[model samples]
Target chain A: MKKKIVVCTDLGPALSLLTLRDDLDVVVWPHAVDTECPRAWLLENVQGASGLVVCFKERVDGEVIKAAGSGLRAVSTISVGYDHLDLPLLASRNVQVGYTPDVLTDAVADSAVMLALMASRRTNLTTSLVTSNAWPAFQWTPFALSAPQLSTTLFSPKRTVGFLGFGRIAQAVLRRLTLGFGVSDAIYTPRPEAPPQVMRDAELLRGLMPNLHSLRAVDMPTLAADSDFLFVLAPGGEATRHLIDESFLRRMKPTSVLVNNGRGSVVDSTALAKALKEGWIWGAGLDVVEEEPHVGVKHVLPAEQGVREKCVVVPHLGSATHETRAEMARLTVVNVLRGVDGEQMESGLDLGRWQ
Target chain B: MKKKIVVCTDLGPALSLLTLRDDLDVVVWPHAVDTECPRAWLLENVQGASGLVVCFKERVDGEVIKAAGSGLRAVSTISVGYDHLDLPLLASRNVQVGYTPDVLTDAVADSAVMLALMASRRTNLTTSLVTSNAWPAFQWTPFALSAPQLSTTLFSPKRTVGFLGFGRIAQAVLRRLTLGFGVSDAIYTPRPEAPPQVMRDAELLRGLMPNLHSLRAVDMPTLAADSDFLFVLAPGGEATRHLIDESFLRRMKPTSVLVNNGRGSVVDSTALAKALKEGWIWGAGLDVVEEEPHVGVKHVLPAEQGVREKCVVVPHLGSATHETRAEMARLTVVNVLRGVDGEQMESGLDLGRWQ
Candidate 1:
């Protein structure tokens, strides 16, 4: 009897992983199927499912675990965060959980930096004027939409950088910011008792940037007030729900830029919309939002209604690179195979009280 | 008695300068009306004229110089180049001449760098897709049209920068390119016997970039073949006409980018258009053209028709910055004043036979 597995969500590079195991009976669901299935469908479909590979959209909760019964031995996700999995139920069932992490740090960091530059420099706006064929007829004066001069000195004379959560992605973004964009001072909010790796990374980055100043931990108010550009890189969990609310945005400078490269649930979209319309910030570049993929015409609020006309929105693509995605798929497959073989998994999530 | 001045070619800035000297009487022509003006009009306009302010657009040939009659002592131009002025005729007539220079360097350098980055990174193309709503419907794919990954050190293993001419503006642009873009090697075309100041500047720059490989002089073909990006900054004169024709462009790699900040005549536009259309090179960014402000649908050739579609073209705004333009205007005023007072001019053009 071969081990059976069910793959859910849009399996991008993940599909390649399934081809590696010849002995496993792999069933791939390319579309997001609804949880409720006909009685005959469930009986025939998941009768021999020994493992499950899921994405953020699939709700693998208590009911799904009960449906798999005792045959399911492990569950793995193709994402860094495992919020989609119900840890309590999976632990009680003695099911191992694996995820992909740390592989996407550089790609996400690069995207964050690009967004910051595009927003601050008004690249999208000026390029639009020229490509739309409006430039030749439009009367252009000297001081029209122009790029802000970014000095190459380590210490930027004007702006400061702040990170909502001090994590691996945030640290990578800071390194690029200081070296490439000449940012100096940085303020971040860290979890209690900062990790040793965070301190070591900070020390190494400081050595590279001679003029780096004030890499201190701060509260939300201080971070909001000091940052000319704020990068949100914290994970989405109950503990950090709505970290950036209306009050936090109100304290930010009107000329500041806000970028979101992490889980969008951490920021209140309505509050950001209000801030942009009210002139509380210069502009924003968002790669992720609270509701994604389905961000249609409804998501695009009028400039006067809430979001500023200058705000540039991008669909979630922080890790959208050929090299990065292939690496992620390779690592995810290794984690799944290790869990199934009863070996210690590379990136297994802790079950804590549920165990 | 007051000194009389005749103004030609829109006496806006020149009229303002004349207002500073209350002892001088300024006369403006209603329509470049020198040819149409009767002898009575000339007698009335030039009863005591001793100075003339002319623009490049106006014809100030030998005939016009004699028409101004014997009283004219000096002729000043608001422009930097004096191709329109009959320099030999003025020298024979013993008429002192003045023009503006060294003031528009910073603005031109800024535009040059902007074009370099835009062309190299495909900013114009990507930006057009985003703003025109031509970006495909949002899908979480591994590859998307996003800003190029600039922070990664992998692509630029050993970056090299090259300049065709090492003039004042080119040197300034070199400073920004090396510092901001992390370029190492800097090769430039050599002048006859490098001046001590030029050697000293090169040494100082080498110190700034520890990884700088060499700053040696090279031929045109070698410069194009070896450089990742090339900057054209040579003067536009008969001696250097069409210096970067088809053969030079053919030597460049497909990945290399070409930027033209010098006079348009220095580059053969027809050759560049063909190069872009045939994909001989990646892309080009041009601020100056052979017949600028006159390029339109009819001027484009069928084979070279796709050049504008692939290239990023800007109206001649190389020296249109607010700060640089103000400085140029002020320097032009000073040049005019010096010519009238018979004092040494700060930046007089060297109109010798060799120059």
Candidate 2:
């Protein structure tokens, strides 16, 4: 008898779970729209499955492992971060969790730079001036539409780009900034007890950027005070919650621009809004917020209106590109198939707790 | 006797005519706002002036040239394109024209890439969703907001970048595309004369861009057919007006993106609108339009509304950056000072017609 593998969402035939139909019993939650499979439906359909597939939205906890019973061998998710899955519970059940990583680094890094440009260039204000039929009345002055210049030039000599976390995505973002803007120097927060490989990676980045004279690993206060453009690419969770709060915002240069492509909780939206309104920072660009996907002009607080006016916010689309998403889907299917075959999963969680 | 010079706009002291106030009598436009000096003001104030400084907004016609009354040794503009100043007319009066070029190449190229990424990534649509409080109700699907990926990945391997006219700005853009996106190949329309130096530059570009195995000079038909991302960086004029019209748009692949940072008249808004509406192309990002600052969502036919929906339209801000604008102003001042001092202008127009 073929082992059952249930996919929580329909991934279409090109990246479908049904590709394993000959060797495994494949059950797909059928939906033609852009929504998650209902929780009730997932609970009912996940029974007696050897494997399960999920995207970023689903929260697979102890209940999910219980529903899959003793048969589940793998929990594969189509995202880099396995935040939604309770890894400890999965480990307890001997179920290895699989995730898609490195595949999305380029797309997310591209997004971070885009957000930085949008904020510094004031694209939202300028584009609205065109769409609202207000351009004719507006005059073109030297500084009329001018905001902070993102790239270095003779007039704006030094470009100090800082990263909250110097990881793969942040490194890619740094490469683009250096190549396009001729950035002079960089500062980033180092992880505690960083592996020697990460140190070599930082050195490699310094060599790649043409005008970059230095790439220093700095403390938080120095990073905030020195960076002309500060990018948050740190991981999400309790430790990083509100890392960029009122105190941090106050320490940042008044002319600095803040960008967040990391998880929402890392930045205190209310504090950021107040900072923008109070002119503590020039502008901000956010891809994630505390109440994201539900973010509006008033999502965080009444002060959140400042984000709509002074910030460029996009609904968590750091990896929302055709190539990246498709690759993620393909990897998801592969992870599950590999797990069921008793072969090591391609990117299975290396939780020492499981051993 | 100090030479009399009239500056049409006040470039702050950093790039101001006031810098030459001790050497020449400088008359600056009184207003602090972002508008061009009125034509009548220019005609009246230009009397007996040895040099006149102007931006793109001022039309240097026979009337203004005639008002200077033979004392105008130089007519310097703080812009690259001399479209606003009639060269033939200036040549007739022996007025040497000076323009700032090569200085702004980086800023404009940066804007071009920004626009390309914005359009292909659906930034406008996604940003609007966040600001309008619409994302909560919407579901997150794999392909719902998927756009033509700007970069290469395993799932989408090939990336073909094309240029309508390969000039300095285009070259800079190609460099960024190659470095950031890992593009595979490039195609560009060589100038009719096809100088040996131009061929050398293309070879140099291929060397600079890693993963770019091929870079070829192709004809118009092949350029349209082969490109995945088509950039119009050609000069603007009647000869190249509406170059990307119905036929060229039709020839383009549906997945191809059209970006125009060259000039307004190069891409016909009507044809581009139609192309986007019918899905003849994926999307477009335009920083320039025929009508320019006067471009409203209603500027073209009602079909043109499709541009507002499917395209990313920024105000004519290709070189609106603070650093670039300041440098242009300084160059304009230097050109005027050099012309007045009987020294050759830093970048004077060699109008052979004067001889």
Candidate 3:
């Protein structure tokens, strides 16, 4: 008998890679593109499945494990974050969890830089001036529409880029900043006892920025005070929640821009909004807000008032590029295809947690 | 008698560099910051000037030159272009023209990339969706807000960047593109008999993108046909006016973006608007339009309807960064100061046209 593999999200053509296998039965959710998979639908469909596919939006907790019963052996998601999955339970049951990590590092880094540029350049204000037909009267004075630049120039020769979490994505962002913008210095707060340096990236960064003055591991306060552009790329959870609060923001350069491209939970939206409103920071670009998807008028970051006037809220789209998303989907299918056959997933979580 | 240097516009504290020298008299346009110096006022004040400072806004035509009489020996503008000045007349009168170039190159190139990201990522669409408090209903499916990424990745290991003019700014742009985004290939059209390569940039590009597939000098048709992101960096005048018209735009890929960061005259705004409305190209990010400063609601590019929905019109702010503008102002003063004393201006334009 063919093993059943239930795919919860519309991962476009990547789903075909799974459905093509005659040895497995792939059950896909059929619906409009905009709507997410319903909880009941996932619980009902995951029954008697050897493998299941999910995006980050889907929940795979104890309730899901109970619903899928003992037959489920694999849970593959098309995202790097596996927060929704009950990992301990999965490990206890010998069920493997798979995710796509490095595949999205560059794409997310690109979006981070995009947010930085958009915020610093004040595209929101400039675009409004154009769309409202208020551009004709706009005169080009020496400083008109002027803002901080992403790149280093003769005037501001010592621009620094600081990353809250110096991991794969932050390293990628640093590489881009060094090469593209000629940033002179870098400061990052890596996780405790993180590898000092990846030799490949170290060599690459040096080659890309020959006159790179320094690259140092600094504490959070130094990161806040010294950064011309502070990027929040730390993980989301209890330890990191509100890490970039009022105290952190107060220490930042008033001319500096704050970009949060990681998780929304890492930044406090209320403090950030207040910072922007009261000129504690020049501008802000946020891809992930605390209360997202439903980041309506009431949300502090998108309130349409002074609090958010200088802030740019982007719907979390770190992996929302055609090529990246497609690759992620294919990788998701690949991970599940391997795991369901009782083999090792290309990028699977260590089931040794129950040890 | 002390030589008189008429500083026509407020150049911030960079003016102090000129004013501090007691060998010259300084005259500034004392008025509201928003208003440009009236033509009459400029004509009236430049009567016995030995050196004059102006930005691009003031037209240094026959009327102003005739008004300035024989005393005016230097006309230094804080800009790269000399279209506002009559070069033949200036040459005949033995007057020198000084401009600020190279200093603003990186800033403008940075803006070009910013526009590329903005247009391709649909920042206009996304920003509006965010600002209007309509973000709650936005769902993140695999392809939600998906657009062509600026960088090369595993899924798209063959992205190409094209330039209409391979000058300093375009080369700087290419450097950033290669370093920041990891574009795989580059193509450019240089002026006839322009040098094949700058060794430093060539080496830098090779190092930054070790897997750079190609860097070629191609013709216009091939540039249009081959590019995923076509940048219009060509000079503006009757010769290059409307160069990027309907025919060229139609030849462009549907996924391509046309960025005009060079000059307004090169791109025919009406043709671009139609192209955008009918989807001949995916999007356009224009820092310059055919009719600028006064590009009102009736203007083709900012018509507030179908014509510009997918287009992003930035008011010619390529060099409007705080760092770059200050550098340009200082350079402008240096040029005028040198020219006034019958010395070679640091970046003076050759007045050999009437030779």
Q: Provide the TM-score of chain A alone for each candidate, in the order shown.
A: 0.84, 0.92, 0.93
For model 1, what is the alpha-carbon lDDT of residue B341? 70
Q: Which stretches of candidate 1 lie over 4 Å from their true place?
A: A9-18, A30-47, A67-69, A138-140, A152-159, A187-205, A211-226, A236-255, A263-280, A293-309, B1-148, B151-355
Write candidate 3's Cα lDDT for B1-355 as tens digits.
9888887776877888988998888888886256777888898999889998887889999999988889888999988888889889989999989998899888888889888987888777787687677777666577777888888887778888899977888888887888678888988776766766668556756765575667887888888888999888988877788888889989988888889998889988888888888888888898888878778677877674765657888888888888888888888998898889899999989877684
Ranking by DockQ: 3, 2, 1
Q: Estimate each model's TM-score.
A: 0.63, 0.95, 0.94
How do the residues A1-355 of candidate 2 rate in per-residue lDDT, one tens digit apiece? 8888888754655454556468788877777255677888789989999999887777898898899899899889988888789988888778878898999888888888888888878787788888788878887776577666777776677889999888888888887788656777888887667654556756766567566777888888999999999999988888788989999999998778998999888999878888888989878888888767667656752136445557888888888887787788787888888887778888877977655
Better of 1 and 2 by TM-score: 2
| Candidate 3's TM-score | 0.94
Question: Which segments of model 3 are wrong by more than 4 Å?
Answer: A154-156, A192-209, A304-309, B191-209, B304-309
By lDDT, the candidates rank as 3, 2, 1
lDDT at residue A184 of model 3 (Cα atoms) = 87
Model 2 C-alpha lDDT versus the unseen true structure: 0.81
